[model samples]
Target: MNEHLTDPASEGPAGGWGSVKSIARIYGETLSNPAVLETLKQQNKPGGFMCVSCAWPKPANYHPFGFCENGAKATLWESTSARCKPDFWNDHTVLELRDWKDHDLEMAGRLTHPMRYDADTDRYVEVSWEEAFSGIGAVLKRLEPKEVVFYSSGHAGLEASYLYALLARLYGNNNLPQSSNMCHETTSVGLTKVIGSPVGTVVWDDLEKTDCLFFFGQNPGSNSPRFLHPLQEAKQRGAKIVTFNPVIEQGLVSFVNPQSPRQMLTGEETVISDLYLQVQSGGDVAAILGLCKVVVEADDDAKTLGLKRILDVEFIEQHTTGFDRFVDCVRTASWSDIERESGLTEPDIRRAGQIYVEAERVIGVYGMGLTQHSKGALNIAMLANLLMLRGNIGREGAGVCPVRGHSNVQGQRTVGIAEKTKLVPMDKLKELFDFDPPTEDGTHMVDAVKGLMSGHVKGFVSLGGNLLRAVPDQRDMEVAWAKQELTVMVSTKLNRSHLFPAKAAYILPCLSRSEVDDQATGNQYISIEDSFSHIHGSIGKRSPASEHLKSELAIIAGIAKATLPVNPKVTWDDWTGDYSLVRDLIEKTYPEDFAKYNERLNEPGGFYRGNAAHDRIWKTPEKKAVFTTPDQLNSLSFPDRPGRYRLLTMRSNDQFNTTIYGYSDRFRGIEGTRDVVLMCAEDIAEAGLAPGQTVRLVSDFEDGRRRELGGLVVTQHALPKGTICSYYPECNVLNAIDHHDELSKTPASKSIPVRIEAEP
Candidate 1:
């Protein structure tokens, strides 16, 4: 397969008529007619369903049509008219479906019936809901609690996730692992240890009042386009924007708001970044350390001159610890090492540091670029250190913001869907449910995969995600997944994971966030938390595609009722009837955070959970924020060899995490295919390769395993020399399962060492 290349759009801005056209095309393809306008209007509104795309926060005064291009794609993708019925499943065999592409499988439409894999015929047959639930429970009853792994995706709502977590604990284990383990686990672990909070301290209003916005490894234009509105407004108010990324994402260069009629008519583009430092892949740690060094040296100069000290000495002395050690570590870092690792000169680093020092209030935003590396947690800690130098945390308009991918991923963690036993309030769970919750640590994503491969884990339960398509070492995950005794997937549509069935596999259709979910009591509303830690209600307005489809909350409750013995204190049926009862239970379990959960959810723009760090009240052991130094100065170490390059995987403009929307990547000037590797012109020639040539990438690892991806077309890009980029999941084959951060266990997908060779 070869990719069709084209010059990227250099005329219009990022979100102008191009976005409008893309939205129209998706609606046309999905046959989302008459309901399109209604769905678009309701998205991100006060009483409307949350967009299932990104976790960007909804402003108090939200736009009438607040949806972005990708948001529209997600909404229509879920609300499409096409249906996958019993007939479709009967005609297609599991072995045949496994050969289909990820995009084609999802385009087959929403699952409309409960299905069970028939090993005799190698095909799926429709099964009654009761029979499916009872059969799954029978298998669960026979196996040890530790043998089953319960997984969730960001697509699940807060109500469903809370019940899912409770069901796992009540079943006598804490083996709950979800999407965050692969993405922002580093941010949560690093920030909690330093500031005593896992979530970002800044809110939506803070973006509007900030003096400087520093973006590191985050591309909001594609991942979260709604965020561009804030950046546009911030730029207009004279705020400086600095970016540190390997690729010059179009979204970061300029933007043209489709919501603004004047800019749409005039074609005027607002420039986004004042300084764009193309940092090498996995170089965030060194770059941040260089910034810290500059800040500390500037403070010394200011003190010598008897001028105002550059550091926030009062805030540092009163509210923090270990600052002296952190400063000493930064002062000792070598300038040459910083330049070589960061791929930038001292002048550029000083310019960015000067911008940081001059600003009164700054907000630092980042994404997987920093967290998907071996030094992921350390990268987050270094950024926190830089912010602390100026007393950025716990302030009105300043803090660190980690942009999450899924709409409710952060919410899922907030509601106790974690693998760590100590992360949840075990005492509260036992008191409310009248059962002794498990105390042992459970498996995370990587550990779960290892368990399956080793045959230690016998069953798999997924609330809403394609595990096989999202994780590393895809070729091995599929084989390991097939060996499970039982597999259950509760989802709205069919994906690749559903095809790789175990001895006993079932696919249960569920109501999506866009469709109305009616229970025994009345219409139901689910709550979702955004990246800003705000919780709000989402009421789906569209009609259901099938009569047999059940709500996620209902399905989870049914599974719990069948698998666990009835407890007098826990009433699954009543909670499923009315979600408010679940909220009451949540409030009782987390009195400090979820107090008045249902009442406050009705407020405009919802309510903030209020991080202790934001109020300058650290909850650490010493009751103060602490700064720590990284153990290593280098982000990555590679042997000196020719034809070696650092390969990073990214998402196309037309895709979300593993969910490919189309074949075209308009931002990168590629069209008609996704089977291509982006490389710098110099590196291409040095390797005796040229643009449009098909090449194979072989990963270099110490394990001595042969990990290669073949038949990938080469395309020219503006990346730094010795660094290459490709789309994720497709290129995940090159990422070894064990190559990840030691502390957080996030796969090092952003910085894989690989060699390119001509495809034989």
Candidate 2:
């Protein structure tokens, strides 16, 4: 596992030769049969299966391949030719498998049967689906409704997520702790408070028409490679793209379109960013404040300088409130404070501000780098203010775009997957489903883990994803998982979470998005919503990997029926038989938005789930977009301690969230290892450390506990002084569960105060 293969990159661009090699490597390793081709074909065709890699909006016209390299990896990982059977489990025990790597565990292949943890043998033994359901139901019925927590992930389809929420509420608990709590909870909470909606205003089509696109802490080449196509087109159309980040990500600099054979063969790359600003860790708020201050200064001197007015005075006067307070806050922010906080000079901030002043239609794009902080909500508010200052909302090519992580994460929320009771409106549930939903607010991820540790959460059910590995404080999460009285996981493949068994644990295998679900009513298809609120269907056309595997929807129905044997208020059998019935119920719940859910899926490119901000329809208490002025002084203050670096957790180019596709980060010039740290050369020299030196990272927190990780090989890069980077989940140990955004409860993975030392 410690074998390091280093081939420092010099020439090839991302998505050109690197992607071809990666795709070939995936096919070679997976040994996927020809059936995978049909799986991919259905994945590309309209109204077919949608990619579960990311929530990036699909184009009106899709590529013949219809997916990126990472998307292909996710597909191949799901549709691999390997299988983990009873024999495989008999050969290895849970404690022995604990030594396996994350990718190795995923590579163990799909689970073909329902398995239950046997404490005597310390292995998972095959069990009947009925036995698994009955055992889990026994615990569910014994515990109080509030004691059970239902966790959901973005990988689950909207239909399954809706049924999961319904089942949890019907059983009497609203403790719906979802993956969104770890990814974009800030965007969901912050944007709603500012512009009266949880999603972004602009659609995918707007990228082609935008005059200027500002990237705030987003790396498209790795996270969303397909997004690069629109960016490439926008660049060719004379759109000015500015990027703000800490590290010099290769994806933001240049890209070679893999779809184009000419560019792939010849090294003709498309330049993405016109200007790159390297801000310090957790400095987005300061950088944005400085940019806003420069914009206001330009507006003040527009007439005197013989320049056109930059700020939309009419839009501000009529469509916004608190502009006066925002302006006052920006005016008082001194350049000295901005430069110290942002690690950028006054000229650098103004230069980017000048570009913003000139563009007519602008869109601001951001990812977890901006939202995974203590001041995440305020950071989002400031970005909204920047967009609103120029009348960016209610337009075709202007608004904010929060690049979401998992596919259908947004769709799940739309169909009803939330911890807050008010977000779903219980009265509507009572009207349509005849069930009185829980009125009390449920626990989020942080609180859920706390509840599990304190014995408050007795029973746990997961729709998808490895909750233990994905959450912060890995040690504590494992302990919490063991404390649960009953734990049931509905999954397609084997993962790390299954190894951490509870007193009563069951692993129920479910069909993946690439597998056809044959229910009582022929085939069933599920729909998902993209980042831009585009609703489309994903009908799996491939055969099931194993006959024992059941559809997630069917499993949910079975569990619901088993848990409430006497209840007849809700019809789980009816919804599971025909998925359209679920859609009909969804339409009744959201009459205006999902009026013709089935008919809309039949459209050429599916239907656009209209954005309220796009139409200037604010659903806020003030009935207008509100401006927020965040305190610059209260920003994440770097400790005065010497030799401490602000370590930011990042994903390798080949990895997506917790899923490691490979060991190489081809785009970042690191190959053959995820066990390395990226830091500034100067910082290494300052600490008296040499190149390729092995070191351990010790996190500093207010709580009197030292979290340390050793055996990391250091690599020097052009990172900002006192800044370092490491891959997530591996570095997740350094992140204290309590160290999170106060407003959103999202872990501060992007900005953690740590001190590096030589491994002893």
Candidate 3:
């Protein structure tokens, strides 16, 4: 327990009146009186737009208010009355604005017009859309196709993502690296190898029927609040919930659904987790291996007693491969190593194993915690092995669920925003668009940065997101960003990324998901895929923030038209006029998954994109799911040194990916600042530091670069000894650009090695 934590509310149940107050604060700050009520009523409704926040699935049964506090904040944040017109940019120079806080920059307002950075004046001057697009096209045409990278954020809708991908392929390169490369790329790579699917097999219906829910390294309360409702319901129905994380997250402890009038009025809370294990940082692989060891031992004992087999022998034999090797590896793992690495005793591991064995069905939910590590893919593969021991996957109420952060990150990938050439269907693409996409593999986020730094990539075009803040090694990224010959950002507002202008930079304003996108045909509806592999339509009811802003589809089309040669088969004009034409192209490209894409938009809850793993149909080369064994039990190995700790980067309750909403993390007892580091008291004292002491975190990476973040106040919290937690983007500098997962190349942001030094 965090005895010295200041905020008392952090110890209380999540949601309830606290959430209501937060929503009110956001709405009050951004929206007017009547519009607030209208927006609230329409949020997550059939005809209304999706909450441009977390990608948690919308419920089939609608509640009075379907959106969560963060979701409401995201909606109002986009719909804010503030606007950043030409005059505002003229007032502030790029150099002066670079020092402004990320939150302050975005709060300045939504961008109203296309603007170009004038290096001589160090200010952004308003420019016509045609001139901006033409200049960008001219520069892109000067470089080789592989020299330009097209980066997409998760916020892009499916139609826009499809067109963006098509534009990139038509331009002759597949350098379509997006935000997911930094987060869930491990899940995609690991799961594909294990179960023959990149996406999760679980659906919304599974949560309702699950016998047990295991949360690994994810805090749903802060990341995705609406997920708490399902956890509360699961608890009420006698489902056992277990959590394995370094911090004792408030959401995993208990929940009070704000939607439930009776519970809210009575102040009653549902206890969420039956067992909470505070696993050490980067210890998930060890913990999972321990559980598998216990299960295997128990099965061995049962076999000796001639009793009914505890393991799912029939399912294992029929549906899985590599089981014998996986079991052998688990059996060889020493108990002492597991306990020492996992920071959990033998009894606790057995206790959790017992719950898994007893539960008829179980769903393993995780987020960036398990993915942003050197062995991130192995971490996921180990979790899959744990579920496979009892055949928990490919069954009702059971599967591996990787909770995605952005609204449509998975959907963007599904539509074709990948750097890997093999991930996209080249034959269908060539047939439909009559162009041969580059066979050479393009760059992921890390490699893209390297390309920029080395001057190999000359141009960059972003669909959305603050790429500068989202990536690791901030200083290096900024320096690399400036090396680009041309940089184009298609965004809703000003961000830190825009401040780091290249030789030729353009910030083109685009319609947000919450704003009405009126095309030549009529008001357009875009489709977004949730984390559960469910695709649905989102139609914005609010008016556009600025008259000069264009739809993402239109901006993508504009770039396509200006850059690529006219293809008789490709119709950018028609697609821009009606987004359904873009959907038609998408359906033709992925006929199996997106058949009848436009018609399904009218369905009440949309439709499931469908995963072969759910039907026990493995798409692996061997046509069977495979159990994998890690070369080592622990994901990271650190020497025993004083003043050294593993730093876990996290988001505050008031923040989303790269976008800071406020300084306070309401759920975590943080207030008035985002520069505090949450450390265990034992670790603090051992490092000759006290609570509230100002310290600088220094990370010395294998690349021979020393990264440091200063002015971070040390605060005591409930975390594993020798491990600390701090908000991301601030601490992202501590992670080296090249320090990432071997297989997935996702940055190892969650477990960065750092030493705390007291600031004079």
Candidate 4:
């Protein structure tokens, strides 16, 4: 753990993307006892806190320490001895540090003081919090408010989330590029277009009633381990679970419940999945299409073959539009085309469709795997389409569920963080805050990055998040980031964002929500919305990381007070002193589920935010769930084409976003490396590539930029011919900045077109 302090030199095979390799290398050399336990014990005391990197919600009867390996590392990193003093920055230049490895940047440790970059010396010089804010405010005042884009990450709490939104509106720019833009933006784009909301309609209890669950593109073992217990319970009750993904994840295959006593003591594990389908990368579109085709055929042949109609004719006749167009869309799609694009035969699609027909109720579960693609929104819409064919929506055990990355990312958007349609009317804002709201649509991450890079964006502020690391073509991204006139990152421990400084930058340390948030009134509770749309309140059970740390809400209020002091129209002081006031304002502005939110959150586990779709009514303009028929997609025809392989970039079990937890992908038998690529034996030989050769992958995109993954270990895994799997961020350099969904702007990091061959 101590050795992780040094600069990173190596990126492992499968976990090769992040600083994990360097960190592991550090631990392998430095720490006498690399396995540092007692993090929760030290950080979970009466007041001190741990990092929120891997806080997977536990089961009702589970212990507080039920978190996985990543959680432990995050907690340890929080309470570790690593510190970034002024001397550290004084010792290194910003330009020089940018060239360092990803792991080395993180291992640099907790930022002790704020600093601003000196362009003349190309170094970061320490700046006081006051001086930093004033310097930043000067930059903001110099440009139009629209020139500033206020971004946020999930690490930020309710107070900070609200403060960021408020700051955006007050500063005259609604350009708030949030973490949601990358992670669950597809969920939002698809769901909101179908219904009125962006979150899943299913609740946790619904898992018990489901007859079958279709898990897609999500690796629970690494992404969200807490899901395993509920899956076990559902399995015990005999729910048929099917997993659809390009990679055969171990968590989906089987796992021993560490939470169970006998299993923990005896080293026994439980079986998880019933079926595994290695669908083509970015082929979620094809997979869903093929499944729907089988359902359609089954429905068509029902009368003669003793089959039941999978299409809900009655529901479609009454509650949908453009059924004829949808029917034609599916009917026109050929099986051969689906097979070529999906890398799965017609039989695989038929089998999956048959299972859906057999189950009385079906719940569709997905995550970033299905979202980070060019056709992601369409893929999500297709999942809903398949479920709707069997009348799955509004049922007790069936609906669309996206396992969100962070704890409360959904809740932030539900409140006032949104810069678009959910915005309260100008009259409402005037009535509540005595001001006019902005009419412009706020800039998302893609647009924000472009805006900043082009100099249209001058000032930038992030509540919490590593914006540069999360974006694609990472090497080129820093140049765009460095162009910001002013940048402020409100965070807990120091991260890449601090080192990726601006002309004027401030790293205002803040208290994690796990730590007690003190106010003039008393210890206050904050609320977060979960994957299942449950609105629960959380109060810090522990103390702040340090006395110098302030609540995110407090820090935001402080900035607002310092930056917007000249006007003093509304009571910013009221918000700074207490977060409850912000809650009250939320109630007034969006008074739907948040009515009496403060009082409601005080109750244990919070309450469910109403899902109107559960009642058999959608909030669409037509008031019914419509079948979306997107454009027909065919696999790479490879018409006399050569040396092409479909590459699907993914994250390891020990990482989240840009944070690498450790150096192992336990499920894949990948240890001490992340540089390996999973492929079929036929594809390797067909491309004339040997097993242990250094290789280069060229994107089929017109940009002609080549991605080289040197020294890759080739495995004759189950990955089908023309399909390959590699770790993300490392391959993100190949994904052009503009390569994304036109509607949602979600980075097509998963479904990039590339050709791989051994490097000579």
RMSD to the hidden true structure, all candidates: 2.8, 3.2, 1.9, 5.8
Q: In model 2, where do residues sit more than 4 Å from their true spots?
A: 1-11, 305-307, 633-640
Candidates' C-alpha lDDT: 0.87, 0.84, 0.87, 0.68
lDDT of 4 by residue, 260-332 (tens): 5676566454556666777867677778888888888888889668766668888788777767888788888
Better of 1 and 2 by lDDT: 1
Q: Which residue pairs does candidate 1 place in steric collision?
A: none
If ranked by lDDT, best first, what sequence of candidates would result?
Answer: 1, 3, 2, 4
- Reference-based lDDT, residue 468, model 4: 72
Query: Where's the lowest-lDDT run of ten residues in candidate 1?
Result: 1-10
Structure candidate 3, residue pairs in collision: none
Candidate 2, residues 1-760, lDDT tens digits: the string is: 0012111342345678888788889888888887787677666457678888998877767778788887888888888889988778778999999899999998888889999999999999999989988888888899899888899889888788888998888888789988989979999899999999998998866787898999988888789888888888998989988888887766778889988989977879887888888888888888888889988998889967988787898999988989999999999889998888788888988989988988999999999988888778888998999988889888878899999999989988888789988889689888766667788899899999888878888888999888888988888778889878888998877888998899999999999887888888988888888888888788887888899999888899989888975556578888888999888888888877887888887454557878888899887789999999786532363453786678889988878888887887876778888888888878888888887999999988668888888889989877778779998888888988888887888988888888888985
The TM-score values for the models, in the order shown, are 0.98, 0.97, 0.98, 0.89
Clashes of 3: 0
How far in Å is the alpha carbon of 560 misplaced in model 3?
A: 1.3
- In model 2, residue pairs whose N, Cα or C atoms come closer than 3 Å (at least 3 residues apart or on different chains), thus clashing, are none
lDDT by residue for model 3 (288-377), tens? 999898889989999999987779998899999999998989999998999888888888888888888888999999998899988999
Deviation in Å, model 4, residue 340 alpha carbon: 2.1
